[model samples]
Every structure is written in structure tokens, then in C-alpha cells.
Target: MQTLPPMLNLNDLRFFVMAVTHGGFAAAGRALGVPKSTVSKRVAELEQALQARLLYRSSRSFTLTDAGRDFYEHARASLIEAEAAQEAVQRRVAEPSGTVRITASVPTAQQYLAVHLPALARAYPRLHVQLEVSDRMVDLVQEGFDIAVRSHFAPLPDSGLVQRPLAVEAIVLVAAPSYLAARGVPAAPGHLTGHDGLLTGVAAGTWRLSGPDGARMEVAPVPRMTVNESVVLLGAAMAGLGIVPLPQELCRAAVASGQLVRVLPDWTAGSVTTTLLMPARRGQLPGVRATVDFLVNCLQPAEPAGSAGQ
Candidate 1:
């Protein structure tokens, strides 16, 4: 019988892949929450096992050799398949008792998902949850995340993953009572141009509003400040800085507390759909299913009254 090649170390392969993908040993170490020396050592061991000089390292940079480039393509694919296999087996378990990792934008995690997690824990005491909050779109399978929550104004692109609608998010214009008292309230969408605006995302200076009867208008306001995070914009608006468009659910507490007031009550800035996404293979996993069900149950659609514009 022919003898097989020496068994490769899976951990070493993982470190090697991570180092290449992340650009350096230090970066891979930070991502893995390990020491830079550990990452370097692991990759060295992988090279020794394969009997190949995979990387050319200098004081300033490292580049993959021809052999290393060829190996990386296969190694990355193998890692993805291995993770898929692990998830497939985990899905066969009947109880939701292991760790389930989830990713969502920072504001969504803090304002919506975080509040409901305690109830989830109460329902499934044995399930451990790992929540990662970020603004970037993460590759769910590559990142080993069980689920992702995303918000988009238009239909999301077809990603081949299973998606479920969580809520229809209404975008509404808001301002602190102090701001309106000082600058005068805007009675029509056209009047928004004269107001100081606090803006976010790509639509910093522009807003599209739709009335209840489906009449639409676009207005461009001169922004006093621009920020990327909704929570920060909300804070600025509440501090009497400027009028801002925000997701209704994110500012509900402030509106209820009378810290912020709706502007142009007859028109909505726009609407977005909040969605829960997961790899199709993980749909049958007990932990994944449980988390999906929990979110669907907990996150009810925003009441018209709660949104700044009715």
C-alpha cells in the first residue's frame, strides 16, 4: 500500500492562512487575539511541515513565494469547506446549547438587539451568545458567524444566503425642541434646505421624503456636521445642533422623553428594511433557529405613532 504524506497540522495551516489574509503576523495576531510571535511560530512550523519556503520576510514587509501563492488558494478553500463541515454536524444537534456568534451594525446591536438578549438568555439558559458589532459587511461563513443583521434602503443584493425580514424601518426627520424653538420648524419638505442639518452615511446632504399619499420630494440641506454613526447624529440633534434623519426605533426613547420632536409630521424621510441573514446550511442548527425566532418575536414593527412622521 502507498504511504500517505505526513499529516499536516490544522492549527498551523490556520495561522498561515490568517497571516497571509491579514497582511502580517502582527495583524493576524490582533485578529486572533494571540501574540505576534505565536503567529510567526505557527506559520514557520507549517512551512517546515510542507518542506517549502512560503514567505520572503524583511524588516518592512513580507511577500508570498510562487509556492506560497499556489498553496494559499487551496488552503483558503479547504478552510472554508472544513468550517462548513463542522457547521453541518453541529446543525444535527437537537438542543441549542453551544455558542452562537452574531454580527450587526453598532447602533442596531445597541438599540435593538441588546435589549432583547436578556430575554433570549432566559429562554435558553444553556445557549452562549457572542455578539460582534461593526459597520462593515462581514463574510458570514469566512468569519464563522452564525447570523447577521443588516439594514438597507433598497432590496439587498442576492448573496445566496437565506434571508428573513425582521422589520420595516421608517426613517424620520427629528430635531431637539430647543433647536426648533430657536430656528423655527419646517412645515414643508422644501423648507428643510434652510435648516442646519446633522447628516450620516452617503446621503449626508441629501434627503428623499415620501408623504402618506406617496408624493415624493428630494431636498439637499447644507449640513452643519457629518458623522457615520446614527447614535452620534442622534446625540448631536438632541443637543440642539441641527435637524437629522434617523431610524424611528433608534430615537424612540428620546422622542418619548420629549428630548426630540418630529419635523414635518406629514412626511417620512424614507424607509429601510431590517433583515436577518444566515448561511443556508446553518438554517437547521438549533442555536441559529432559536436566535432567528427570538429576534422575529422580539422586534415588532415600529408603530406609526412611534415614528416621527405618521
Candidate 2:
């Protein structure tokens, strides 16, 4: 008789979920409250039983392979439903316990995530967040990241990963009063040629705007004093370098303090977005769903008037 390999036990399922989730063994063990070696051993056993390479590993980190992703897509939902069913009948209400791997940039973390997130952590003590901050794009499924965020002006790739609109971010042209006094404010978009330009070479050119009448108006590009990455665009604008298009969150305090002036209030560029991208498999899991929902709620645009960008 052709002997079958050992059945995938519940312990294997738990570890498999953990490894793919945390993006590495160390995080998985931390969440599972077990030794790191234990997590590694169980996943290795699970891989052996399944007769497939579940993850691609290296000394620094590990990520899921294609077959692992497929298996995860199917198994995660099953596990969540099974766990939820058991929890419904059990006296001990189990709080959501799992790992959520995230890819973000320093700007997003400092400006938005700092104040908006963390409520989720307090709500689910067992939930673990592994954040990788970089300005570059990330492969959601390959890296095993539960959620990835970016404020990109470029077109997103046609990956099968699940994506949701986190927020419709708008960039407003702002200048400090000191700058306006020194260089004088341009009355119209074309007059920007006379002003000192703070260019964030990240996306060069004149900022585009949609006016009250829904007409497309093109503002002339400003010749920059300093050309570099857009990461510090807000700081340059605050130092009165020149008028720059900044996310509302970045210029709020300056606007409130009357240190900076919002130019062309009727204009905003819809080209930018604060989006949430996640692996389709992880999106199916209960803890992943809960975290995304919570973030969406936090990113909600205020009704009419909202808080300033800090």
C-alpha cells in the first residue's frame, strides 16, 4: 500500500500560519510564546509532510513562496472560522492573537501612524506588528506582509494582491509668511516663476490642481534652490525655501500657527493616495481583517472641517 505522509496536525497549522505571518521565526515565536527553535522545527516538519517548499529563507529574514501563498490562501480562512467557532462556545473569550507584518515609510509612520495606530495593539494584546519602514515599494505576497502602505504618484503594479483605498490624500501648495514677504506671493499660478521654488525632486514639475469649477489648471514648475528626495519637503517649505505642495497632515501646524499660508485653497491634486495593500491570503484571516478595518476607520477624512496635519 502507498503510505500517506503524516496528517497535518493542528500544531502544524498554528505554526504554518505564524511563520507566514510574522515574516520570520523570531516574531512568530514571540507571538506564540514559544522558543524560536520550536517555531522553526514545526514549520520544517509541516513543510516535510506537505512535500513542498513553504518559505524562502535567509539569515536576515524569510518570505513565502508561491505554493506557500496558495496554501495560505485556503488554510487561513479555514483556521479562522474553526477558531471563531470554538471561541464562541468556550468560557474564555479568546482575544485575537496573531502577527501582522507591515511595510511603511518613515514619513507615514511619523506623521500618520504615530497617532492613529496603537489603539489596535491595546485592543488586542496578543497581536504583534512587524513594521519595515522604507521609501521603496514592497511585494505584498512575496514578503508575507499583512499590510503595505504607500503614498505613491506612480501607477500601482498589476499584482493579484488585495488593495483598499485608505484615504484620498490631497497636496496643497503652502508657503510661510516670511517667504511670501521676502519673495512676494504670486497672484495666479503662472506668476510662480517670480517666486523662490522649493523643489522636492521626487516628482518634478508644476503642481496640478482642480478648481471649484472642475477645470484642470496647470501651475508652472518652480526652479528649485535645493533638489533632493521629497521626504523633507515640509521642512523646506517651513524654512521659507519656496511654495511647495504638501499633504494636509504635514502643514497643519504651520497653517494653524499662522506661520505658513495655504495658497490656492480651491486646488488639490488627486494623483496621490494613502492606500492599504495586503496579500490576498492574509486579508482572509480574521486578525488581518480586524486590523485593516480599524485602520480604515482611523484614516477616515473628518466631516467638513478636520484636524490639521502635524
Candidate 3:
């Protein structure tokens, strides 16, 4: 009788490579156009066949067990070879052409799609995009959004969403020049407590008011007028309601126009970051890939590099 190839399955090996590369089974599943559970099962089967735990899964992190470490050392070449083979097959096909729908928050929605999209539209005339702007989270499939750009810390759940980081910007504390001159600039960060605060429902939207000797505190802002949207808060700041913590993009125009002044130039406040998220499917649609490629270029720091770049 012929002996079956030692303990591991090639398919399982493929799944393992995908998991490590993508950082999780779900992400791998999205890339492979398979259900997340299918990815999990393949990895589980591989572990059983080898009688070795390859991945140490934790609530917060994923690590390679000793066996996984050893496998990674060698299997990368095999994976690369397989990709080369696949790419050779795909090259015979024509370039991407189709309609793509993308979603974004107010700021990027206006900046990228409204202003810059014309260039992309001119390049791939056949390639069109339906743009949706909103602050609420979108269900890509249900809402028919082909891709989305938004700021978030946790990766989108394994629910058929593929997320890639773009860039991160600090949430700056800014006020109108008149407001600062009138208040004579607070003596310390704590004095900010006395100033009005613009608030939002988002976690990163919350401000950590800083003070002396690492003296720090938080402002539970109940703005006389609260807005869930970043754009609205920015408008409130421009109108001089009080101090608002905002992403650089939100205040950039105002600061340049002298409609707003950056406060506490030395002290950092909150942050705003963005990610590119898409639906999991084999052979990405033409419109989707185009947007992804452009966004990769748009969000890069010094061309491109880790975390978001990765």
C-alpha cells in the first residue's frame, strides 16, 4: 500500500500560508473567496494531521507555535512559486473594466471621490464608481458598496469584509485665532476644562485633555450641540463655538484660511486614521481593484511602507 503524504495536506498548507500572511483565517477566507469557517476547518485539520499546534490564537494576538515557526522558514518559497504559476495564468486576461461603488466618511468622501475621481474617471472611462457618503457603518453587500474608506482600529469582522490600512493622522486641538486671543490661551491643558468641547460618538473622537507633570484628564463633552459627523464639528469650530479636536484633514483648509488656529501646538490630542475595506471575492472586480490601487497610492507616507502600508 502506498503511504499518504506524511501528516499535512497541501490544501491545508495553502490555508496556513494564507492565515499567517493575512493575520487570520477570516481574512484568508475573504481573499480565497471561501467562508471564514472553511478556513478555520482547513487549519484545524492541518493541525490534527501533523498532531502539532501551528498557531497560538489569543483574544488579542496570533502567534506561530514552534512547528509553525519551522514551517514558515521553508514554506515561503513554495508559496511564492505557486503565486508565480497563478500570475502566469492570469496574465492572458484583459485589463479590468466595470462599475465600482465605494463608500467613505464625509471628509475623504469629498476629497478623493469628488475632486480626484475625475482623473480616475478620465483614465478608465469604462470604469465608473457609485459614491456614497455617510457616517454610519455600511454593510457592503446589503448596501451594495463595492469598497469603503473609514477610520477604525479593529479590523472589520470576518463577515466577508477585507480591510487594509491606508494612513493615520493625529486629531489636533484647534480654535479660531480670535478665540485664542480672547482667552489669552489657557495656562495649561487642564484649563481646557473650562473651554467648550466638541464631541462625537466615535472612540477616537473622544479627547484626552492633557496637563502638567503628566497631569492628564478627559472631557465628558456634552456640546450644547453635538454632531456624530466630523464635518459638522469642524463647522462648529470655524464658527467659534469653542475648541474642537479634529483630524488634520478636517482643519487643514480652515487653518490655511486663518478661519481656525491650531491650539496647544506642543500637546497631542486624539487621532484619525483610515483603512480600505472591500468585499471578499475571488478575482476582484475591475472597478474595485482600480480604487484599491489608487487609494494605496493616496494614503502612503513617503510613497509606501508598514502597518497601514502593509
**Would you list the rank order by lDDT, best first?**
1, 2, 3
> What TM-score should be assigned to candidate 1?
0.66
Candidate 2 regions with alpha-carbon error over 4 angstroms: 1-94, 226-231, 269-271, 301-310
What overall lDDT goes with each candidate model? Answer: 0.86, 0.74, 0.71
The Cα error of candidate 3 at residue 41, in Å, is 57
In candidate 3, which residue pairs clash? Answer: 171-270
Residue pairs of candidate 2 with colliding backbone atoms: 249-309
Q: Which of 1 and 2 is the better model by TM-score?
A: 1
- Candidate 3 local lDDT, residue 302: 30
Candidate 3 scores a C-alpha RMSD against the true structure in Å of 20.6
Candidate 1, run of 10 with poorest lDDT: 301-310
Per residue, candidate 1 scores C-alpha lDDT tens digits across 96-179 of 778899999988788778899988999888799999999899999999998999887677899999988888877888999999
In candidate 3, stretches whose alpha carbon ends up further than 4 angstroms from where it belongs are: 1-94, 153-155, 201-206, 209-224, 301-310
| lDDT (Cα, tens digit) per residue for candidate 3, span 1-310 | 9887674566777888888999997799999999989988988888888788889987788889988989875677677887898897675244456678888877778655566677777767667678888878888888778888887534456665787778776666788777677765765666776777776654433457543345455644434456777778888888778787776766889999999987776555644557778877712776677778877776673321112210
